[model samples]
Target: MDLYRSGDHYVLHADLPGVDPGSVEVSVEGGILTVKAQRSERTEHDVQWLASERFAGGYMRQLSLGDGIDSEHIAATYQNGVLTVTLPVVEKAKPRRIEITPGASEERKIIEPADAPEQANKT
Candidate 1:
């Protein structure tokens, strides 16, 4: 499985060759993401097999999703024997520039010490 960030969201890719697409299940419970699938090989009666080295059975994987992840918007898809999961980050977690408002210094007020009455009156 390969997981990496792409733009505003993170993507996870897993290879599941020969696995039935209908058997693939993606779910998020609490803060964990889980992937489940099954692979079944063809069988024939009264046949001899030269070699068989393919995995066939129930397969499952789980990932812990920390804070800032928008779990509600998370989505998954299976295509070409590959499973892709998209994890979107919340707006507060993304980096953004804060716009500075101008004219703050223009509204400054001059203050003089109480003991310096001459300077206060001059201003």
Candidate 2:
């Protein structure tokens, strides 16, 4: 399994040659993603004894997602014996530009009411 980030999403690729696409299962729970696949063994009774080096059995893989990941929008695709999974970044976790406004400094004068009495003594 190989994982890398591409644009706003993280991509995961796995090689599963000679495996049926229908037998593969993917699930996510508690911020963890799991992949399971089954490769059936060949059943030949009249064949001569030969050396076998290929793997034929149940395959599984799991990954723990971080807080920045958007688990609700994950997507997976299988093509040409390769499985690709896309995990998008959360909206709040993505980088954004904040606009800043310049501050204005001004002075104001206070006016007294005509009915108010003025001070008679200046000390």
- Among these predictions, the greatest lDDT belongs to 1
In the range 1-123, model 1's lDDT, one tens digit per residue, is: 999998889999999999999999999999999999999867777989898788989899999999878999999999999999999998888989999887756776666677589776788
TM-score of each: 0.76, 0.76
What clash count goes with each model?
0, 0
Model 1 weakest 10-residue run by lDDT: 104-113
RMSD of 1: 6.7
Worst 10 residues of 2 by lDDT: 114-123
In candidate 2, position 69 carries an lDDT of 92
lDDT of 2 by residue, 4-68 (tens): 99889999999998889999988899988999999989887888868977789999999999799
After superposition on all C-alphas, the RMSD of every candidate to the true structure, in Å, is 6.7, 9.8
lDDT computed for candidate 1 = 0.92
lDDT of each: 0.92, 0.89
